[model samples]
Target: MSRAFNFCAGPAALPEAVLRQAQAELLEWGAERASVMEVSHRGAAFEALVAQAEADLRSLMGIPDDYAVLFLQGGATQQFALLPMNLAAPGQGADYVVSGHWSQRAVAEGEPHVRTRVLVDAADAAGLYLRAPEVDAAAVDPDAAYLHYCHNETIHGVEFPAVPDSGAVPLVGDFSSTILSRPLDVARFGVIYAGAQKNIGPSGLALVIVRRDLLERAGQPRARVLTWAAHARAGSLLHTPPTFSIYLAALVFAWLREMGGLEVMAAINQRKAQRLYHAIDDSEGFYRNPVDPASRSWMNVPFWLHDEGLNAAFLEESREAGLLALKGHREIGGLRASLYNAMPEAGVAALTDFMGDFARRKG
Candidate 1:
């Protein structure tokens, strides 16, 4: 049986090649007659797997030797609190660029733990999130612990086309929805984190890349599990880690490396997004993407049908046509097509073709 093209925001699509490989090794991962999940994380087999994973990820991202990559549990949402807890000193504030729902949540989570300063809130007068606001470098507080921003706003379909200028402040990014979809300058940020469910692998794992120097700045966290230093000290094996998720993520990293890493992936992703956006743009007022063109997200594209009454029918037909998870979030009812790395060009082509056909019939 063939697989359907999945457009889920998370726990999303993974490379079919990786899935097949995992299926082949489900019972025995190597010479050891046990699956990767069954093996002790402390064992040599798992250790080697993790090391290779880190190496491949580093190579793929061009991560520096001065940075430490930690494969952690809990999703990116957990980091909302942990980041401020670990990075900020008593009474010290962190600056945030509130572009959409996730960034707003990060600020709310950090407020009780530390002083949270809003640098730029991108919402319009109606509180609608539609663009990435421009940052004034002069307004950023130099004494702030770090300047935090979401690399991509998954829900709002907004993305920072380039890294924001932080001036003297160290940049921190929540890259959950955008990581590995393109090349990133790891050296520009104090920390970068992503949940492994989207482009990486499955849920239950978050990958954090932190600059070595900044690790010492981590204060006593509210909990031991929340400390970046502790996780770094134990090599992300502080406790029983998410073994299966990490193993799957390792497979993804290897798969990414084989596909010529992020540089190649970026080009493919760009083309996929372009084709879909063209379909929407050429729909002759039948569909609309509200996001600012400059801040449009390459990974997630959300568009609305002019006739809202047609949404259910559109989604039903899309699902029947082997395009799954095309329904947008309930908060913002429309349609969203998440074009993660694993979503092939063929999927985008099929979706665009369907959209064109549907528009011609219904318009």
Candidate 2:
């Protein structure tokens, strides 16, 4: 059976070549008697796998030696609390820039733990989830523990072109969808966390890259599992880690290395995004993307049919055509095509063809 083009926002598609490689290595890896999934994380083979994954990822993202890369479980969602617990102290506050659904949820998660300050407010704008409000750098608290923001608002289909520049405060970025899609300045962020499902590999693993100085800042009173320092100290092997997910992520890193790393991936991703956006543009409001052109996310593009009643039919037909997960997030009722790193150009072409056909049929 062939693979369907998946546009899922998260727990999303991975590179096909990576999957095929894993299948071949499922029973045994590198002539070893056991699969990567079956190997002990403490064993030398798995240790090398994990280390090599970090090193490859480090090179791709230009991660400096001053950072610790942790392959963890609990997804990026868990980092919402873990970050506040570890970084934000009792008296100090953290600024959260709320651009969309995930950002609002992140603010709520961090509120109880510390003094939560809203940086970018978009609450008054009706149905404008796709545009991030312009941030005022002067208004940011210089003494704040960390400034948090979602690099790509998955639900809203918005993205910040560059990381927010808040003076003296380390930036904590939730890069769940856009982690490896482009080259990133790892040094700019105090911490960056990403779920493995989207651009990296399967679900169940979250990769967190934290600056060494930030990890050494202070420890919390919670269980050892909750502290980034504890996890870092154990080399992300504290207790039973997500062995399978980590291994798959390693495979993906290897595949990325083979494809000339992130620089090449960025170009391909840009071409794919431009093609899809052009399709949306040519529709002449027959279908409309709500996001501001500058703030639009390359990973997920949500657009609406002028006739809302046609949504169900569009999804049904799209599935039949082997285009899957084209439904937008429920909170913002429209269609969303998450063109993650794994989505091939042909898949986007098929979706564009389907959209054009659907529009004509509706008309």
Candidate 3:
């Protein structure tokens, strides 16, 4: 049987070639004839793998020498708390621009650890997260430990039009959904972090890119394991790392490089997004995407049916047609399609074709 087109938000789709490579090597990885998971991270072969992975990532993203990249366990949610603990003093000010569910959750998680302040709340008059909020550079506190924002909200299908200006204050971004989708200006921000599941490879691993100088700050004391500086110094092998996830992410990095890196990816991703959004818009009363056009997420596109009663029929038929995981998040129920890098353009074409057919019969 053929593989189904998956549109899951996190633990999203991965490139078919990467999966084939992993399968080919799953039985025997190195000299010991052991899987990567069975091998010792301290071993030379696995250490080399880690080194190459970091080098590939650095090359793909054009990370500067002044920054350190750490691959650690726990998803981006853990970073919500760790960000404050590692970047700020006890209850020192940290400015957050709440754009959607994830950023709001970041504020909730960081409040206990740092002096959290809301710079811009994107909620509409009806308290709906249907639009992306803009952050003003002047409103940012210069003395604040860091300015925090979510570059893309996976749940709400909203994205920042561009990186918000932070001036002298260090800007920290949760780029979990849109990290490798396009080229980035790494030097513009103090730190950027993402969970591996969405665009990289899988869950159980998270990536952090931070400036070396920020690591020198006397942050709120915590376990060395939870400290970013310790992980950076130890080269992200503070303890038993998620070797399998790292291995998978490394393969993804190689795939991205072979495919011409972020420049190629950005064009492909933009085309994919435009095709899907156009389907939604052209559907007239048959479908609707509530997000503002300027703030629409290129990664996750959430939409609704004119007649909500037909939701189950649409999902069932789409599944039968090999389109899987089209259901929206439970928080805001409707339909969502997450177009991660690993998701082929053909998948989006398949989805739009299915959508048009469904709307015609069920409209």
Candidate 4:
């Protein structure tokens, strides 16, 4: 059977070429006798793998040398708790801008560790959840440890065109859903983290690129294991790293480079999003996207059917038509098409064709 276009928000699609290469090299990576998963991470080959991956990432994002890149475990969800644990001193608070479900979850998780001040909530805009809120940087507490936000709210289908300008305060961002989709000025952010599943590679590995100064600030009462300084100093070789996932991500980075890097990827991503959003807009009320047009996400596009009853049928038909994972997130009972870096333009065209037929028949 042929592969279907997978639209899952995370654990999403990976490049076909990368997968094929992995299959070819699974038994022996170059001259090594073992698979990357079977090899010791401390070995020279794996060490080179780690260094190259970091170098590629640094080049792609133009990350400064002063920042340390740590690939840790526990996913982005873990970082929600770890961020506050590391950044927020006991009584010192931090600002959380709730733009959607993920950011709200981050606030909820961080609240126990620190006094969470919700700086902005954009839930009511266009009936969507997290979005780029109308926030005034001056409103945030000057003494707050840092400002945290989710750059792209996956479920709510909202994102910021650029990082929010929060003055002197360090900006921490959850870039899980949208990382590597486009170019970014890494220096603009104090800390940026993302789960590898979305645009990177697979689950189990989470990448955190943090400023060296922030690591010094994570002086928690807990053991050093939770601190970024510990991990960075140890070179992210802590506790048997996710060797396979990291290797896969490295392959993905190489694939991106072969395909002309993030600049070209960004252009393709923007075009793919524009095609689908245009389809939604041209449908004449048959389909609607709830996000504010200006703040809509290029990575994930969530649209609703005019008739609620057709939801199940739409998903079923889409599946039968070889489109996989068209179902929306449970929190939002509508279809969401996540056009991540791995999803091809052909898939978007196929989906638009399906939407056109479904709308003509149902409308």
Candidate 5:
């Protein structure tokens, strides 16, 4: 059977070329005869692989030397707790703009560690976030440790069209879903972190690109293990790392380079999103995406069917048609198609075609 187009939010699609390369080298990697997973993380082979992964990512993202890139375990959720602990002083105020689910989660997780303040809550009258909130640099408290926002919300499908300026206060972003889907200005952010499952590779890994100066802020006292500075000092080799996930991520980074880097990926991604959104809009009332046009997500597109009764049938038929994981997140039930870096243009074409056929019969 052929591979189906997978649109899961995380553990999302990875480039086929990367997967093929990983499969080819799974048995014996490098000049040695052992699998990459079996090699010691501190050993020459794996260490070199990690170095190359960081270098490739640095090149791909144009990260400055002033920033220390750390590949850590425990996903982005872990970073929420660690962010305040590593970047903010105990009981210090940190401003957060709650645009959607993930940003809201970040506030909930960080509140215990710091005086988390809501700078902007983008929810409408019904508590639905259909747009990204306006965040002016003036709104950020000058005395705050940092101003935080999510780059994109996977469930609610609201995305910030531009970086929110935070003036002198360090600007932090939770860039999980939209990390590598396009080019980014690394200089504008103090710390940019993402879960590897969506655009990077697989689960069990989180990538943090933090400015070196911020690491010296002497945040709340915590275990050396939870300290971002400790991890950076050790070169992300302080303990047992997620070897397999890092290996896959390294391959993915290489694949992105071969595909002409982020600029090319951005064009392809925009086209895919535009095509899918056009299909939704052209269908009249058959389908609707409630997100504001200016703030609509290029990575995760969540749309609703006019008739709620067709939800089950839509899922069943979409599956039969080889369009996988069209179900919406439980928090907002409708439909979602996460177009990560790896989903091919052909997949979007096929999905749009399926939508048209389904609507013709069901509308």
Candidate 6:
């Protein structure tokens, strides 16, 4: 059977080239007689694979030598608690810019560990989550352990076009939805983390890039597995790690490099987003995207039809047309299209065409 265009929020689509390459090497990786997953994590072969994955990722993102790139188990949800445990001292507060569901959850997870101050929240007067609010530099507490924000809110389709100003406080970002889709200034952040299921490869792995000096702040005596210092010291080989996920992620990094790095990827992603958004904008009140124009996400586009009754027909016809996973989150019912790095321009074009046709038939 042919592959369909997938728009899942996570465990999302991966590059076809990466998938094919993995298939080719599934049984025997190079000269080794065993698959990558079967190999020992401490073995020379797996070590080399992990090292090369880190190197390629660093090169693609322009990660500096002072940063420690960790391929860790558990998803970004684990980082919510780990961030406060590692970065914040007892009773030390951390400023959080709550824009959407994920950011709010991060705050809730950190509250028991440390005092979480809401620097800015994006909910409107009606308490509806619509867009990311502008960061007020004056509201940011200078003495906070760090400032946390989500680069892109996958559920609400809100993205920060620029980094928030945190003054001297270290900036921590959750880039789960937007990582590798564009060029980023790695120096601007003290720590950046993402779950691999979206743009990278598969579920069960979280990638963390943290400045080396900040490792000293992981002073809280937590479990060995939860400490960033231990993971970094062990070279992310602590307790077996997610071998298969890391291997797949390595293949994806290689694929990204071959696709001309983030610069080329950014242009392609921008074009795809523009094309889809144009379709929504030109729908003549038939489709509406709730996010503010400035904060709209390039990765996730959530829209609602003027007549809500047509949603089921739209989804059913879209599935028949080979477009999968277009349903929006239950919290905010509508439709969403997740345009991650792996979604080709042709896929977006097809979706736009389908949208136009659906509107015409139902209008």
- Candidate 1, position 299, lDDT: 96
What residue pairs are clashing in model 5? none
lDDT of the structure predicted as candidate 1:
0.92
lDDT by residue (tens digit), candidate 3, 242-319: 999999999999999999999999999999999999999999879999889999999999999998899999999999
TM-score of 2: 0.96
TM-scores of the candidates are 0.98, 0.96, 0.98, 0.97, 0.99, 0.98
Worst 10 residues of 6 by lDDT: 129-138
lDDT of 4 by residue, 76-163 (tens): 9999888978888889899999888989999998888888999988867365574588768899899998899999999889999778
lDDT of 2 by residue, 1-363 (tens): 568888988889888888888888889887569887677788888888788888888888899999999988888878888888899777778888888888888888877788899977665546466576776778788878888888998888889987888777888889999999989988888999988888988888889999988887773567888888988998888888888788888888888888888999899889889989998889978898867899888998988888899989999999999999999888987999988878988999999999999888886
Query: Any idea what lDDT model 5 has?
Result: 0.94
Per-residue CA lDDT of candidate 6, range 1-363, in tens?
699999989889988988998999999998889898799999999999999999999999999999999998789998999999999988889999999899999999988898999988889988777777787777778889999999999999999989887778899999999999999999999999998899999999999999999999855668989999899999999889899999999999999999999999999999999999999999999999978899899999999999999999999999999999999999888999999999999999999999999999988
Q: Supply the TM-score for candidate 1.
A: 0.98
Query: Which residue pairs of candidate 2 clash?
Result: none
What is the full ranking by lDDT, best candidate first? Answer: 5, 3, 6, 1, 4, 2
Write candidate 5's Cα lDDT for 1-363 as tens digits: 788998888789889998888888888997779888899998988899999999999999999999999999999999999999998887789999999999999999999999999999999999999999999889799989999999999899999999988999999999999998999999999999999999999999999999999999899989999999999999999999999999999999999999999999999999999999999999998999989999999999999999989999999999988889999999999999999999999999999999999999999
- Give candidate 6 misplaced runs (Cα > 4 Å): none
Candidate 1, which segments miss by more than 4 Å at Cα?
none
TM-score of 3: 0.98
- Show where candidate 4 strays beyond 4 Å: 125-131
